[model samples]
Each structure stands twice: as C-alpha cells, then as structure tokens.
Target: MIYQKQECNGALYQMCLYSMGTMPGMSPRQRAGRRRTTEKAKQEINRRQRKWRLMQLINANFVSGRDLFVCLTYAPEASRARALEKFHAKMKKAYAKIGLTYKYIAVTEEHDMDGEPVRLHHHLILSGAHGVQLAEVVRDCWASGLADVRTLREGADFFEDTAIYLLKEDCHKGKGARRYSTSRNLTPPAEPVRLRLGEEEEAEVPPGVKIIEHVQNANEFGRYEVMVGRIYNQAAFSAWWAAQRRKAAPDPWERLRRRRQRKV
Candidate 1:
C-alpha cells in the first residue's frame, strides 16, 4: 500500500510539472501548445500590426483604381470564366462574413501536372482587415467548415508558413525540405502586403457586387512576378507623389505674408 501511495504522489507531481510546461518529457509541440495565453495574445497582436503595415504599403503604392488585388489559378482544362464565377461566389460569402472589400486578380494559367486539371486557385488584393495573416483567414474558413481542410496545402507550418503563402523562399529552402518544392530551382515570388484600413473603420464595399473573395495564398502561375513588379512600380509612383507634396512648400506669397505678419 505504501509503495502504491508513493507512485501516486510521483505521478501527481509529474502531471503538475507537465501542466506548468516544466516536465522534461514534454514534446516541442506540447510545449508550444502550453504557452501562456497572454504571451500568445501579445504575439498575435504584434503579428497583426506587421501584416497591417504590409497591407498599407501595398495599397498606398500599387492599388490605384482598385483597392484590392485578387489572383486566381484556373485548371488548364477548365472553363476559366466558370471557375472565376464559382470562386467569386465563395469570396462573396467570405467577405460578407468578415466585412471587408478587395479587388480580384484573374489567373492566367494553371500550376499542376495531373488530370485534376479541373482544379482552380486564386490570389486577391484588397483594402480591408488590418493585421491578420492571410493563412489565418484561410484557415478560419476551413475551421468554420465552409471549406475542406484537404484543399489546403499539406505539411504547412501554420506559424512559419507565411513565406509559402506569400510565395517567398521558405525559411528552410535549400535545406532538407527541398522535397517541399513544387518545381525545380525556381524561387517563388514574394507577396508582400500593405493595409490601409484602421481599426475603427469598417470596409465599404459597393452594393450590387455579385461576389467577394480573399486571396489567401500566392499565385502559383507565372503572374506572381508580374503582380509584385506592379506593386513596386506603384511604390515608386507613390514615392514620387510624396516627394512632390513635400517639395510644393507653402505658397511663396503665403510665406512672405507670414513673414510680414510675424514682423508686425
């Protein structure tokens, strides 16, 4: 009886340590899951801020007539228009639920080699929802049971997987994870974001719009390069505008008037 009692106490102690994340046998996954809620909240808040800034930069620079960019990938054999229409329906619901507005980028090609040539994908740029990773938004859709989890790319690390969704070099690129690549020696385009919406502001999507969609992932076709380049060009244009704004100082007459007033 004493031996059993001692074993019970030992087990209880180990369990307490486990709950506190101090146990030696805990796996990394377990430890990560056990992180303090406050810490996780802080990290989430900061991540939102970073993502929001990206959105703002993109919007201020690249998006001129339209505020959002949406990219879609249509299967080689599929009807591109129909695929876009279906995707548009999905996107409409998504935006209504989240309450945001974005512009769509039509896909110019497919990105696979199988008879699943009927499959479709999309990329989008929009002006709404500051400070959330596009992947999180996509995952939320899956979690809501609106979409199937299988549709999402597998083995994607939810935390460090932004580069993949953003189409940038994977942190482990050229490492053992080389098998994760979809093609050979081709680095994906980097999808940077810029957010312009403020926390207190709600997105204003014009009425009579038939659909709204979020580009949760990067373009897999040849257009990623084109879109990023467009954004850079927009950034350059914005920089020029800002420079002109700065250079156009107070009217010379106004300055002279102010000087006289100061002297008087």
Candidate 2:
C-alpha cells in the first residue's frame, strides 16, 4: 500500500478470477478425483507456483521510479557461497557509508561447477534510498565486477517477465538448490481476491485506473482468469466513490406507507 501511494502509475491492484470443476455439474472434489499426476506435470505445477508467488511479491512491493531491477556479477571466486559472502560484506559497508536502509529480494542462478565458477551472478529487485544515488552506490559496492542497473518498466507484463526470468534460476536440472532470498525488513504483497465470473467477464476496477493486462482461460475441467493493472489517478476515484456511497436510497415500501396514511 505504501508503494502504491508513492507510485503515480504503477499497478494499484492485482485481481484474479478462478473456478474449477463447475463446468455444468461436476464438483471440484470430483474433478480432483479424476485428475492424474505425473513427474512432468508435478514439475510444471511447482514451476507455476514458484513463479506466481514471486510475481505477487513483485506486484505488492514494487512501483515505478522507486524500484530497480539489477543484475549483479562478481569476479572469479572459489564458489558461489564465497562470492555472495564477499558481496554482502561490501554491501553492508556501503549501506553504512551512505547511512541508508533498504530491502531487496535476490535470485542467484546456477553455478558453473565445471567451469571457472565466475558465472555466478544475482538478479535483485531493490528499493531506493532517500537523497542518494542507489544504482551508483550498488555499482561502487559491487567493485568486483559489473553491475547492470535498470529502472522498472511501467506495466504488468514487465513484472510478469521479471518473475518468469527469475523463476528460471530454480530449475537447476534437479540439483535441488535454494531458489531466492529476501531481506527480513520487506513487507508482504497484497492478498489475492478469489471470485467467480460469468463467461467473458473482466476484472472490475474503478475509473481512472488502467488495465495493463487481462487474461482468460477455460477448459473442460476448470477456468482461470487474471487481471493485472495500475492506477493513474487515485484522487478522482476516491471522490467518485464517496459521492456514490453518500447518495440516499429512498425505500419504496416506506413511500407507499406514507401515501396510504395521507389517503386515510
């Protein structure tokens, strides 16, 4: 919520509409009973779950202009562990020097076990600092190698693409490694709203907000739809909502009772 308030154009809401096993008359329990699991199917499910959670995190905490998508690399080290250790030490010092506090989530890809082990790098979603050049600070702290810093693009697809790219780090060919790590101070993403929709129905948002992405899917067994987007003008929507809620609703029954009393 704080992030959304700060962002004038970032996504204000993330909404989803999903239904399963209600096609005609089948219950969800019945659909589950009919479903089968395979290794590939299981892997695919895991991948989507991982990506979905990561996307939620992004959508909740990140907004345009105040967040960064960074790729951090390092000089050759003995192992990924050693390189990360050294990087953290440097970052700690840098933070102290800048008198800054921040939160971040980082994904470390696979290590080149057969090669020189220099390819170990991290992709980070980082928050900005007040009155300081965050990217330059990160670059200076990363002294060992290269730091590619970029601003967040304004759209749901950019967020989706980022989540998908980071999810790739988890698929290390069955090596069973850790996925990603986050700073302890970071806040949680928005809770997803569960709902059912009619055919071709879209996620509803107030006026002045833009729908960055809307997708729908259905099958014989289930249906899934999601709408991801941003708000450009919060003030106008607030005013409209207030006006609508305050409008009085005259009761027809009360009006009829008053008329009958007058007649009597």
Candidate 3:
C-alpha cells in the first residue's frame, strides 16, 4: 500500500511538471528552444502578411498601358524627404497645368556611391493618360537632377515584376520608414471569391481565366492557380477562423462561478 501511494504521488508530481512545461522529458533549455521557434513563426507570419498587403495594393492600382514607371534623382544638398515632397508638389502642379489627374506609387531608396556620400532617389509608377510626354513633363517638373520615365512593356506581368523590383532586398530591409507609398486616391484590390468544395467535386476555372499552377501542403495553406496568380483557400481559412472563435468563446458556467466568487 505504501509503494502504491508513492507511485501515485510520483505520477501526480510528473503531471504538475508537465502542465508547467517542465517535465523530465522537456528540460528548461527545451522550453526556451520552443519559445524561440514560436518567435520565428510569429516573425514569418508578420512577414507574409506584409507581403500580401503590398501585393494586394499593387494588384489593385497597376494598369499595363496607362501607367508610367519613373526614376527621379535630386541634388546632394536636399534631404530625402524634402526632395520627395518638392517633387510631388511639382508634379501635381504640372499635371494640373495640363488639365489631367494622376495617381502614383513610389518607393524611396538610398545608395552610397564609391567615395561619395549616400544619395537618395525614388522609383515611381505613375498613372495617367499621358504618353511619351510624361517623361518630358517629369524632367521639366523635377528641376533638381534627372528623371527617367518609361511605359510598362506590352504583355508583361505588371504586378509580379513591379512588386518584385520594388520589394527587392535593399528596399525590404528594416530602414525605420515605409519602403513604399501610394496616393490616397488609389483603389484596393477586390476580395477573392471563396467556394466550398465537396469530396467529389472539382474546382472549376472560369471561362476567361487560365490556370497557371496549384499548390497544396500540410504546413502551408493550399491554393488554386487561376488567371493572374495563386488564390488561397478562403473557405478553409474562414472555417478555421470560425473554429478558433468557438474555442476562444467565454464559458458561461465559468463566468457565473467567477461572479459568485467575487460576491463572496
């Protein structure tokens, strides 16, 4: 009887340690390692969310033929922020003079030239009806150093190429400021339609859209390829979110017990 009681005490002690994440099989170091892994996972989630938001914003406003890509440089005497502000003001005035409206997305970057101080520049995607004259207008309006403008090439994937270029290694680094900005007038992308599928039913592609590729995995979300790019499984995501909310819901009995304890 004493031996059995001791065994029961040992089991209870081990259960307590397990609940505190300090069981014999899991050392403090292992718990700390798990924490590091969780932090990495959180960072990855934040990174992916940022990328998705940027892609969505770009996809909404980008137009192949109507938009112009521009690079602007300024004199060394001017600050980066001041140069950008002045350039924007000048461009707005110039467009107003021409009786046209414009929208733009811009990315700023700084480069340290060989044996020279760091220089600031901008890459801009401007939307307007202006053609080749856009470059001339930018050059004239800039009045600082130089402005190079070109139209997006025909048959090119505007979102893919532009997003990749804008979010390149140098631009994506944590630089204490936003890497890119867009005009407030720019529109957002439409939310993708979610369709639930049965075990036997296959996902159908619309008439005009073409399938590029499909991806499925246990770790990451499954997505179907159609038209422009991969579309994530929104139905699955919605279901998952609903389940999480249900799990996180407050227990009525627990709440009542808490109230009773408070009254005592």
Candidate 4:
C-alpha cells in the first residue's frame, strides 16, 4: 500500500529516477553548517550542479542521432570573450542560412584537450534538423580555429558522462569564470507523478511502452524503484491497442459473416 513519487525526463528513451527513504532534501541546519566548506569543496559542488542542469536540458530536448556535440577551438587570444563574441555572429548566421533553429550549452574552456589552461575554446550541444550539414557549416563560420562535430552518444549513462566530459575545464577556471552557458530553448523535464503502487501492479506493462531501464533498492525506510521507458509513437501504439482489444473482446459480427460465406 506504500506509494512513492516517480520522475521522468521526456527523452526518446526516457530517464525515470526515484529514491525511497531519502528526505526531500537537506535540512536548514545542514545548510547553515556548510560555512566551513573549503574552496575546493565549493568548486566540486558547482561542477556537479552544472553537469546535472546541463543533463536535464539535454535529455529533454536533444536526441542522439539528430543533434550534435561540437567543439570550437581557437588560436591563442588576448581576449577570450571577444573571440567568442565574434564567432557567435558568424555561427548564428550560418545556422540560420541552413534553416536551423539551434539550442546550445556553451562551456568555455582553458585546457588543450590535455592539460591546464593552455588554449581557449568552447564546447556546445547543438540541435540539428532536416539532416543539416552540421560540421561543414560550423567549420565555415569559425575561421580562427577548428570545428569538430560529433553525434551525441547513446548508452546507459544517458549523456551524464557526456556532460561531465564537456565541462572538463571546471578544474582549470580562473577565479570567478562561469562554468557553462545554455540557450533559452532547451526543455526541462516534466514534473513527477506520484502513484501508490505495489509489486503485483508493478508487473504490468502498458501496451506500447517499452521499458528501457529499471532499478530497485530497499532499506528500512522501504523499497525504492526507478523505471526508464520509451513511449512509442501514436500509430504503433494504437495498432497494438486495437489488436489487444479485439483479442480481449472479439466481434460477434465476424462469426456471422463467416457463416454467411459458408452458406454461399
């Protein structure tokens, strides 16, 4: 009879996560005690928060094959901000010319794909449409440096690792530099739906929903479960549903029609 809350990010292969026995969040007292948190601890917290927020935007809006992860690298620059500003002007025009409306999370970087803060660059996750020429367009727009475009990878991590890798320059930031920037268009995950569910009920799967991942954990507080699933398109779902309904409640008219055929 115990009920728990379930959360789903509206991705193609959905991300469903929930935990039981955990308090909603840290208490006020816990927050006040954090005054002693070291600078290193604060940076780690910032990095994790940055990654989590980016992942939400990614899972909700971007898909693996349809979107891209792009890297824009530049020669040594006196002003990193100015270099990025100039690049954005051309990049936006290029995307518009190709009939694309893009959403991006831009992470400013200082690493040389290897060590601490040698080069200046930006990493982006861009929305692609209509089989657009992603790499060519970006390469054309960014003359100062390289534009490497890659398809977003798909796996059990669900782009969590991707976010972390793209934000890898966190440890190399100078003083108060930003961790990342996101375009306004990316979607946030849907609000959670709470259900009172039990073992017998959990065994049932909906007609057209495919469960991709499910995990269950237990403790003195109770059993916690997470389920990730994909909702098939309407046509496929409706066809499956109609077949199930026909089997559950057969049409008597079919029998009569068969009898008439036999008489003929």
Q: Each model's C-alpha lDDT?
A: 0.32, 0.59, 0.52, 0.60
Model 4 Cα lDDT, one tens digit per residue, 1-264: 333433345433322222222234656554333322323334443444466556667887788888888888875544455666666677777778777776777787767557655666678887776466677876776777778888877654558778778767766766687777777666776554444444234423445568775655443333434454566665665565454344332246977988999999
Output the worst ten-in-a-row residue range by lDDT, candidate 4. Answer: 13-22
Q: Model 3 clash tally? A: 0
Compared with the true structure, what per-residue lDDT tens digits does model 1 show for residues 68-179? 3333443345554554455545655777676654333222222333222334454443333444334434433322222222122213211113222433322223434321
- Runs off by more than 4 Å, candidate 2: 1-10, 21-56, 59-68, 77-79, 111-118, 134-140, 143-145, 149-158, 170-178, 195-209, 232-264
Clashes of each: 26, 0, 0, 0
Q: Which stretches of candidate 3 lie over 4 Å from their true place?
A: 1-42, 76-81, 111-118, 130-132, 154-158, 169-172, 191-264
Q: Is candidate 2 or candidate 3 better by TM-score?
A: 2
* Structural RMSD, model 3: 14.4
Give lDDT for model 4.
0.60
Worst 10 residues of 1 by lDDT: 1-10
Write the residue-wise lDDT of candidate 2 on 1-264 in tens digits. Answer: 000111122345444444422244657764563243223333444555566667767766776667888898766743445665566667767777767555678888654434334466788888765455777877876766788998866454537777877776454645466678887766676433233345455445657667776665555444444555566677876664455334423356977999999999
TM-score of each: 0.23, 0.58, 0.56, 0.54
Q: Compared with the true structure, what per-residue lDDT tens digits does model 3 show for residues 152-244?
A: 543433254566666654333664657688888878654322232332334333222223433221112111221233324545434543443
What is the overall TM-score of model 3 with all chains considered together? Answer: 0.56
Ranking of all candidate structures by their lDDT, best first: 4, 2, 3, 1
Give the lDDT of residue 85 in candidate 3.
73
